[model samples]
Target: MTAAPVRLTARALLLDMDGTLVNSDAVVERCFSRWAERNGLDPAEVLAVAHGRQGHATMALLLPDRPAELNLADNERILAEERADTEGVVPVPGAAAFLASLTGLPHALVTSADLPLARIRMTAAGLPMPSVLVTAESVGASKPDPEGFLKGAADLGFAPADCLAFEDSGAGIAAAKAAGVRVVGVGPRALPHHPDAHADTLTTVTVTAAPDGLLTVTVG
Candidate 1:
């Protein structure tokens, strides 16, 4: 027999960008691959830790001895490259419909992308930008630090425990969980993180808002 769908209730929703709503792996791979080769690091390994964290943070992890300032500068260049190269960026399956379902609901985009990068990717993906956003510049710390997710919950006027986060990376899931928000794992990348609910894609998830201001999210 098929298992019953998992249902989660929350006052607001927090969303991660890259792997969750937008599929920008093509650009990410191309940009990071070049950066990795330049630094004499393996592209695959860099990409492995690249998603869901600020570029600077990813650089720091791969090159621990590098000065923080250099990482920051590298992050700027990487963001520029990513922003200019939206060749393969597109919305994930059901992303448009999913966002439509959240109309008039309390939700925020909590992502490691800086504002410009986030805007371009969303545009390339043909997805609407959430009115409430907690991008990289909005927080001092990156994913796995809980800063962005915490700020997202606060921006939506909901306590962390009252929010549900949708993430597609281990770092993003960790950050949400650390901020006291239950997570809905999106895509294969999020599976190992073990979110409260798992969906292969947004196609398997649906959301509805109650008159009392609660959101019911169902993941099949």
Candidate 2:
């Protein structure tokens, strides 16, 4: 028999933003595609590489030969636009309840999105802002590098092995695994490059509703 996906015995959860907790795929794709077109690059290539990476990191990969100042300027422009208009952005199915249930847990938002963009998206989605956010600006590297996830765990006062990660992209999964955290895949199973416990959405996660209004989430 195949072994059950590993679920860590931890008190903290590191949640990813985009596809994991929020359904911002459309907005992200539209924005990035426009950016790519303006830069004379393919939209597909930009989408593929930028899905779970910081904007600056994506710029570095997309325009590796460009000066850092140029990349920064572009990223800043993107952030301003995103923050100003995130109309279609919303939390993933059941994400609001899941996050509400995790009110007392030692969890934090660990996302590749930079601070301003992340906040704008979260606010637009009406999701409670996490106090301990490890944003793109907080890390030297983005997802697929493990730095973001690791930093989140550290900031939460837990080891990576003692944290559970909720991710939706291949890059995010790899980052969580690299950080030694057990992962629960929360979107298209085909997107993840690594093996992990799969769930159709946040609703699929088995959460026990406690009498005191707390939820004990279980990932299988």
Candidate 3:
């Protein structure tokens, strides 16, 4: 016999763009591949730690000796390059309906992409943008720091524990947990991190809002 899905309740939901709601892996890999070649680093190695982080943060980790200014500059260039390319950008399976289900509910987007990059990619994927957002520029630190997730909860006027986060990376899961928010792991990248709930895609998750303003999220 198979076990039942995990059920969680929260006042709001926090969404991660890349890998979670939006499939931007092709653009991410292409841009990172070019950056790696420019830095004389292996593309595969660079990509290993690139997801779930701001470009500068990823660069700082990969090249600890590099100057901060250089990383920041490279991050800007890469963001522009990423925004310019959307060939393979698209919504993750069931992302459209998932967002639709959250309409009129409290939710916020928490992503490592800057607003411009987020806009382009979201538009490319044909996903609607959330009214509340915590972009790369919104936080002083990137994923694994918890700053973004904390701010995302605050932006929605909810305590961290009152909100649930959906994430698709180890760094994102760590950040949400550190912020005291429970999480539902989305997609393959999130499995190893062991979020409070797990689903292969948003297709398996359902949300129902209560009269008292709580949301029950059931995952299968």
- After superposition, candidate 1 runs with Cα above 4 Å error: none
lDDT of 2: 0.80
lDDT of 3 by residue, 1-220 (tens): 8669889999999999999999999999999999999999999999988999999999999999999999999999999899899999999999999999999999999999999999998999999999999999899999989999999999999999999999999999999999999999999999999899888999999999999999999999
Model 3 deviation from native, Cα RMSD in Å: 0.8
Q: Which ten residues in a row have the lowest lDDT in candidate 2?
A: 207-216
TM-score against native, each model: 0.98, 0.87, 0.98
The whole-model C-alpha lDDT of candidate 3 against the native structure comes to 0.95
List residue ranges in candidate 3 displaced over 4 A: none
| Pairs of residues clashing in candidate 1 | none
Q: How many residue pairs clash in each candidate?
A: 0, 0, 0
Specify the poorest-scoring 10-residue window by lDDT in model 1: 206-215
lDDT of 1 by residue, 1-220 (tens): 9779999999999999999999999999999999999999999999999999999999999999999999999999999898889998999999999999998999999999999999999999999999999998899999999999889988888899999999999899999999999999999999998899999999989998888988899999
Q: Rate the local accuracy (lDDT) of all candidates.
A: 0.94, 0.80, 0.95
Determine the backbone clash count of candidate 3. Answer: 0
